[model samples]
Target: TQRYAITIKRSRSDINDEIKNMTLGCNRSGYYRNRLNLTENSRHRQTSSKLLNCLFKLFASRCNNTWSFEVRNSEHNYQPSKDMSVNRMAAAGSCPHQILSTIHLNDLSLMAISKTIYNELYSIRQERLDSRTPIQALLNELQGSDFEFEYQ
Candidate 1:
């Protein structure tokens, strides 16, 4: 039940641009690469990146004590039944909120994989939002803290 926040060092504009370029690069690299479903709009890209960043930080922190973090993006098809029910209730003028399952960080390998996936998706989302020139290199920059979970 630990809470974590992701503080981006760069400005929002810069991060948005970076993510936009990364998304385009990913799309161009492979037509069927389904790692991220990025739109070609700056606004959508910005929102999606921000959302992903927040989720990643939250999951990473939770993973330190658990094994994984379950993502329940309303935009994605992974919403839990309770969430769907809550949305339905809200649409019917009720304020019911559905609870989804929590993802745990059970092992080092799972944590690493989760971190990698988060980083990749975050970069791609940011690039697509910024519309900046795309880079040709793989975006693999990871913080040293990413491995700290192994020791803990």
Candidate 2:
């Protein structure tokens, strides 16, 4: 199975303010290391890993409010998962520590850990945008009003 990560490279932008570019890459597309780090004196256990250091990736750029995408590599060493959505849920929680046990027992990547954190932040951002607070409702109603006020 395969997973992916979304990475963004941004700079101070006069128009968009940020988000200069973005990338999507296979989560397993990197150096392979024996995470077990088994010492000579330590008891050995059979361990297996699915990581293949695949190089599949895509890139995107923004220009004048338009976005363009390009694929850097079209092939993967590992077979694609039958259900990509299942991989999306692989790191669905807010805390990396919550999955530490899984990481120790398996060959999970750091990209999956970061995906969990990003999911949390994205959920929070969506919640705030969809908030039903009375003040927020009032602001929504006043969005195109003729008055402007400074707000943090």
Candidate 3:
């Protein structure tokens, strides 16, 4: 006599819902496993924040239009409303110290990168100041008057 065995497999949507439910349960729990999961989520959040910061810096340097540094659709839903306000104040040249304080340095590695970039910008500003040549003057000299200005 021969016997047949049956196997069961969960659907993709079912698996996804299972994961979402598990994450929600872990978030509510205070066990070590839950803490570890939370730590991993925080790390992911930090990485995303750093990426957004770098992208914003690159875009701000190249594009004329303003870019809002808001993180949407994040796993943890960590928003930086206070940071945005501080950045706005800094842009207006009102609060310098608060601007530095507003930046979130959750990951040490990304924090180092942020510090390095900030130092480089500071050095460039210092050189500009020492040479008594403003950045606008240098840029104007580099690009001749033949370049037409476009108004949107």
Computed on alpha carbons, the lDDT of every model, listed in order, comes to 0.28, 0.56, 0.34
- In candidate 3, position 94 carries an lDDT of 48
Off by over 4 Å in 3: 1-90, 105-132, 135-152
By summed lDDT, the worst window of 10 consecutive residues in model 3 runs over 53-62
Q: What TM-score does prediction 2 earn?
A: 0.40
Clashing pairs in 2: none
Q: Which of 1 and 2 is ahead in lDDT?
A: 2
Pitting candidate 1 against candidate 3, the one with the higher lDDT is 3
Model 2, residue 135: C-alpha shift (Å): 22
Question: How big is the positional error of residue 64 in model 1, measured in Å on the Cα after superposition?
Answer: 40
- For residues 40-131, write the lDDT of model 2, one tens digit per residue: 56737554444567877788777877988898887877654322232234347424454434544454333333455456556655666676
> Distance (Å) between predicted and true CA of 26, model 2?
0.6
Candidate 3 lDDT tens digits, 28-50: 11212334556654665553222
User: Best candidate, lDDT-wise?
Assistant: 2
Error of 3 at 91 (Å): 3.1
